[model samples]
Target: MLATFNSSWFKLLGIFTLNQTEVKAFPMRWFGFGFNAFGQICVHEELIKGVWSDAVNEVKVSTPTELDNQVDTSDCCLTTGYQIRASWSRRASLHLDGFVSNESCGKPMKESRGCKDAIVSESYLTLAFSDRLESWDLQKKEQTPSWSMKLKPHSSGPPVNLPLVPGGYIAMKPPLYRLLSPHLRAKSLALSAEHAILLTASGAVYTWGLGSHGQLGHGGLTSEEEPRAVEALWGMPMSCIATGGWHTVCVSDGGDLYVWGWNNSGQLGLPSQGLRKTLLQQSSQLAGAPCQDASTTPTEEPEEEKHEEVFISIQAFPALLDVTPSCEIRTVSCGCRHTAAVTTTGDLYTWGWGDYGQLGHQTFISSDEPQRVEFFREQQMRVVDVVCGAWNTFAAGVKEEVA
Candidate 1:
């Protein structure tokens, strides 16, 4: 065999070994770019020392800043309101600007699963998982609920009561066990200012809470007491979903993106002029339609009715969006009014309200259509994830290896 080694075989083996080594050595480096209105970017002090004269209006970063040192693990939430860092060893730390109490900072985790989900608002922060939830009030500087509830898991027998804390009963309604319903077992959830969206294990999406802006995707601006399926998205399996302050977004398994709700900020990616024109045309058509009463004189059949038109200030139905001509969207996230999407090919696109430079375009201009963030492409970086805060955007990328 030593005398019969093929040159092509050796070359292939060398290539394979190199590829394996690269894969093993690949390190994930995080970067926080775009808006840093509230120190949410979390950049090193040394790097941004001379960049800003006033803290309120920070400089816009077109290039990525390394954050691996500050963020111990990839499981972290960098929101415009607050930041939560979960270490690799399963310790969690909550950070807020002069809001969190001394006792709650760097608190240890009680659940073995660590912090599975974390959400921050202007006044509070909440971390929840399958078994437990903890909340901290920013104004009061104290942990909320002030009590715990006794509950039994689905596998256990009948429920039993346990001693309660000082704040009376917390009134656990729609009991936690109800979530185990065969048809409504939620796999993930996203919360906005007042709305909540839940994605079931079966690829179905259900939304509840505030529907005033049609963020619920129920084809009506009516709030629901219970979770209701997004009727328009029925049968179209969704893999991921995100909620903005007043908008909702979801991505299908086939890479299709659907958006609904508020359009005042152009977050839905629909042209304002076109939408206004459509609304006017719809009003004209409705005004011209013959009275449905049989007693009224018959008129020409409304120009033969070519197609059905739907209009709503709040898009109560999910509207399919074509961000790019050919790119397939893999994931999407929404800020207060802005939206960001990552394509299957590691391309990042952003649109919607950008008054704070959240769109990553190096300017404070807002866009209606999806615009690719050129920084990543210019640096030959591959964006793997994107997160949007109330007024900022954070992206995680890895350097692509050239073949």
Candidate 2:
């Protein structure tokens, strides 16, 4: 028998699909794009559609591809799976037949734990049961957890996994000690490689943790062990926030977007010399022209022009990012070196490391500014939310339900 990626047991809040393919109209709620070198996105050998040609050392997926899970229940001696989980490097689906398929390596193993939800983190599996969360070292023969945390009956959610990092996560509904805001209450939280950002119910934004890359949004790059309010956005009311490897992006209540931290590859949506130079080399190669090393050929900008340009390598504090005044941003998500945002009008915009087509633009060209993913618009699908993996993106769209 064959099984598909159904959003049943693993019901992440903002994932689903709506398909009108006139064939198997499964809701295309969950769509993936970008790097699939390890098959984390496709969970298979390779995708036939929307896949770009890869170099000798890479597999760049340039378009949004939906998740398809086909299981040979009888053939593999496996039972029907109930849920699936994904990390930066692997995909694991739990089966009711006492087995788990480690899709990352195309191997199925025997298991017999009825977990309600499972999250694939950088190194281990975060299993959520009805009353507790367990951290299991499935790589080891022992199924027992290195440690475990009992959940409160009223706990808000599972520990949110931080992208592109080791042993990094935010156990939300956290202890008062981690949250320095005594009078304010947190409504949202996001973690990066080495820092954390928080949004308060009163519209205040706070950050803490490692700030070597200025991801903390402070005027200087100083790590903060305690939460510090971002004075740069003192009065602005932010609605949402997200973090990448070493950058942060947030949306204001007014629909404006703000970014900070490392812009090494324009992950902050700011001009990046390195990214520009790389794009130029790619363009030159595509045009059959000899590519010049940036070291050998200095930038063509006149000295006077260079002097006048800000040439921001890093924006240490929160900086307003202008996508468009009319495009009111509702939410945003950051990957290892890219960013994606959903507009209020059901539009999606992406930028930064497009080397893997995380931008969903049908090309493997990276950008230093925002660009619309026209594929979804062309299909008349309305984007509601987006989630970014280390080098890929997952988005969910909504459509009028079929009767």
Candidate 3:
């Protein structure tokens, strides 16, 4: 019986002309990266059609015009010469994945060598589409390498797994190599992540790859291949970083607030329906099923603002959070769908969709905005650390001692 099965399989394989012409696609190289025709940065590995397969790295198509191209006129870019400078000692294979914009549209023009001085920061996996990929010597002088290869004609590759130093080569997959080259588009760029922190030039935070729930700060959502920014609070530069399942939160310089992604049970300090139904299944599970239907309404006067059902999942755009703008947020932490934020006054607030008291709220409730959690109210805890989990929230702070 076993031999018959094997023989039958071999015969089927032979019908497709097992011995045909030699096929050579992307040779198994290490890695590659370059600008695409639309000016987005592209990356790839050592395989044929490797970047495109969802099973492999998440490589996708993005038009150059669909990105932000405005140069951040902030002191950071101006002071650094709009060029990324590299510390020779910090030469690591960096992969930066995100988005970039410029003032001009369509095609790129040559800028002065000094323009790249502003880019002299940390290591990254992939970068903005139009950013120039070059090397820096000990003296910080940019060294141009001579190599010829196709770029992403219209595609790019995974944004993580890059070494944090130099002397590494990036392998570019098809279509991507042909589309995105500094020779094609101007100041546009894109980014990706491999379970790491991705800091943008404009004080924004983007995270992707994996981490059950707390790792993405996207609530209790499963996972995402593309990148997303923490949108609750803007104009804050994050320093340290940490991640967990289904959620990811960061701390800012002066302490502000920002979050997005999942909100199953208000874990993100945002409201959401904890109910989950698979693509083929539908279930009506509710925490507080409001009992006000058409029958309950009195034959229609000016109807009150109808509350819409919230389905917490990965968000395409970052949602700005509602927090006391007057209170300076000192730190933030994310869990599966719950989040905690410490104010400068030593006060802590939490929200998002949580089923396991992850919000520290004592009970499950979908909080669409920031809410003060009683767990930290009694203690004048000075939060120093925060970590989020798939369905758990944890924080470490110094308890205020009675003087």
Candidate 4:
């Protein structure tokens, strides 16, 4: 008989050991909603025993208030526990009711560090987080399904047409944009979409927007009004790019990994959190101080006249991953506060935000540096692909059979 509790907020959540040897609690005040507006739970064995023995309170409620638009379940709703239900190759669509703890809760002996709840259906892109649920349609943008549910913002009457940011809309769809010339495609996308990134079939990189902590990789604190190519990686060529909140990481074609921007918790594989904190302190601390060095830069050129000002501040810079030359990583993924990677040798490594076993090390302690996932040591497995939820990790590939 498990005890259950309900509240508008969950700050009172806490856990205690069955032996009474330890007690810990997550700070409710600091428990801000994440990408998916849900919380994750990763606990030790003793603590789970207490929960199952009716010593704890569980939350029970339906989410999204209620399904606004009904769809044909005959075409969807297999409910396998993946965030989206359909395969990535299919055209089916479905809504998900994801709660990190919902799929993860089980007896202590079978603890899982991967996503506990996900509802993915066949859609090209299924992105879920503590803050938002996003899906992309690669088939036909305009002809595809559009949001139908009406949302009532705090003071609103009814949700109407979703408001677009200034200069946010494009007359053409994503496929058309991809088919257009690279320069034209780049110019059309919004500079402010958080997930925006430029990738070449051969792996070049560029970015803009929300560079406060230098997530843009442009070596500046200012968000660009337009797309800017990442010159530092001009010739290197990249295979993929992933963003984690304000931080970013890229993978190279030769199984090499490069990371930069917002390394607050060692997400960039850097030695300090100084760079991240500097960006938050003030806009002036960023590299693109529009007014600095004005006197020395010469005011003769009219185009350069904008440099007329004076101030000293911190600036953003691209920091390379400090890993040794031999690591040879192949795939990279980012969670809201952590990162995971799979190397060519079939080894998996993870770091940052282990509070809910997001690191999959079977521990709640966080690490500042990349740590090989030793949890699978006994299984002798090989992780080929990796995906990260807001606070959990998912990997697929081959693993040795158990005796």
Candidate 5:
């Protein structure tokens, strides 16, 4: 299924992974963790029960917290996994599977013959059907659906007044902002707090916008007006790419993870000043500290004498990270100051700023290297996909039942 969207934050949420024998919906679950001062990642009860207080924003979810939102199933059926349409322009669409009916004619992904795509801006909502694209001016409509839910048998009349949620279908139109008009043949695009990264159909990646934090991956801290190829990543074909507040991470077709840009919060999965300080504190308390592993865990003897304080504040070029010795990466996502990835073996790994437990390691401690989340593993579940919010991480997976 060919997927396309206009927002820089758009990523296919796997809306069509159904069993061949059944065209109906399948059961899916969502697990979220990290900062929730705004209750954006809170479960239904957590959002409704907790009252705003000075210490509320200080609360952080340090582990995989099962997120539950009451989605109305009266008008539609949720056949499969949930979706979180993260978009920079605030425009997004949740993909689902319905059927051919009168209500689906104007649905964003309603039973189209060709590739389906959407463009949502402040003034208009344009949809690309099989043979043609249509636009509807929002200013002309009296009452517009809260982000139109896209899929076959589309349900389009839900009034959405809250923020993004999972477990149901929703089409989120951008509140308003400048639109991204990519001149390149880009297949996937991701937007950071400042920089922009785009992956072409050929698997080559290009970056532009703010580079002050090396988020541009241009080997220097210089901004760009037009898209420029990242020389360090040349010759390698990447399958996925993502951007964070000031960092970038992309997985090659071979499953190797490459990261660049800022490391202040260890977002690059490389040793950062903060992590080093934590390590030093641990070493002072313990006899020996292991720093040989790529995760920078306390496993091997420290090599600090052999090398100066080997902490990276900024990685000007792409750095290969061996997150797991034998496993390959299938997908990756970045938060404002954290990063998360799903391995080929169905394990989810996370690193970086964990002040609010976005790392999902059951702790608030931050790491300078990738650490596999044990929640899913302990539950005998295989994580298939992951997405990052500004301060939280969500992983979608299925239980791996013992035979």
Candidate 6:
């Protein structure tokens, strides 16, 4: 017998099916619409409407474009000088545009995970894997034997790959490597141009390398060859950490953000006025200036005092930053001179160097404090991840209404 079916009910079901299909098909697309001076935006040629060729300029993007290539997974992606290397689960693709070199192509990496997980500096590329660590000289276009080291088995445990030695190992252990030996269980590592930081599973942070700008989180501007714990956060348990060109950031177990190091660009979320005052104070001290009595000095107005409290130029030690006063920060990432953070509610905040719109504020104005990027909120999207290039920012977000 032929039965009459309710067409209205069928239509409703079809609409629901279409919605689900759309959600699945468009699962959070990656938006990389920032600095592209060297063609690091990674969008398909057809997708790029205009180009910004200036060494440090922002791309005028009306909308977020989907990344051309699909990345299944990645250990990390590092950029330096004029090139970018994106590490995948099983391999890595090195992108070098004409701005960087004469050729523009993707160089397939070796099969090993270490080869895929790589870091780059102005003159060299270092790859780290489970078995060994290798270094390639970018200037010479040849591998250096002295720069490479085989993973050695620890006396108490299995083989562990040592951190990348910036220069080369000498007869004596570099101060940084010496400090790392005592703490054999390293949970994570972050590097910049001249410094390296290691976070232990127990929430301790050790840093070594160039400290000219106090990026090491120590209370002085001196480089250390061996890793040294950041005393300011000695007892606080940290969950994650990241380093920029000359700054450092870390999050505590309770989702508190702490920052220190170079504030020349206000990357520390502090005001430059305080830094100037600090420099003057140091200069006076060196000149053996006489100390003024508090009773003889004029009292600062309440508003002026409040302003001074927030205008800090340099924080040699880790200082707690209350950027998301009401929201807890889940993760943080740093660009060459910019900073980005993700809140538990999936909101994204950016600040610091924005000359190339790396701060993602829709404008190329730098910020001294963390500011929320309203693009995600305006679209009813939730940011799930954030990655920063030296002069750019990338974010992935999913629709809030998607089930």
In order of listing, the candidates' clash counts read 0, 6, 115, 29, 7, 7
Cα TM-score per model: 0.65, 0.74, 0.39, 0.51, 0.68, 0.66
Cα lDDT tens digits for candidate 5, 160-184: 1111111221123343223344445
Task: Score candidate 4 by TM-score against the native.
Answer: 0.51
lDDT top scorer: 2
Off by over 4 Å in 3: 1-196, 200-236, 240-254, 273-314, 364-366, 401-403
**Candidate 4 residue-wise lDDT, 291-385, digit = tens:** 33312444566784555332212225555563445878787877766788888876778876655556766554556678777644545666555
Each model's Cα RMSD: 16.0, 7.3, 21.3, 16.8, 10.0, 14.9
State the lDDT of candidate 2 residue by residue for 177-277, as single tens digits: 13244354666667665678878778999898888888888989889987889999999989899888899989998999999999989888888988877
**Runs with alpha carbons beyond 4 Å of true place in candidate 6:** 1-28, 43-64, 70-107, 110-116, 128-130, 142-179, 274-310, 401-403
Sort all candidates by TM-score, best to worst.
2, 5, 6, 1, 4, 3
Candidate 1 lDDT over residue span 1-403, tens digit each: 1112222211110000012233335543445555553344445678778865676656455445654223222334322122222111111223321122111122122221233334344443344433554443323423243223332353553211111111211112212122324457566666665777878778999888889988998887889867888878989989989889899999999999999998866788876543444445555577996334432233665756544433334677999999998989998988888899999999999988776777887666677778998988887889877777666676767688999
> What is the lDDT of every predicted structure here?
0.58, 0.66, 0.36, 0.43, 0.63, 0.59
lDDT of 5 at 320: 95
Q: Is candidate 2 or candidate 3 better by lDDT?
A: 2
Predict model 5's lDDT versus the native.
0.63
lDDT of 1 at 380: 88
Candidate 5 stretches with Cα past 4 Å from truth are: 1-26, 44-58, 77-80, 87-183, 278-307
lDDT value, candidate 6, whole model: 0.59
- Least lDDT summed over 10 consecutive residues: which range in candidate 3? 11-20
Clashing pairs in 2: 16-29, 17-27, 17-28, 17-29, 18-27, 18-28
lDDT of 3 at 28: 12
Q: Taking the tens digit of each residue's C-alpha lDDT, what string does model 3 give over 188-233?
A: 1212122434554355665556645444555444455655654544
Candidate 2 whole-model C-alpha lDDT, 0 to 1: 0.66
Candidate 1 regions exceeding 4 Å error are 1-26, 44-56, 59-65, 71-117, 128-132, 143-182, 273-313
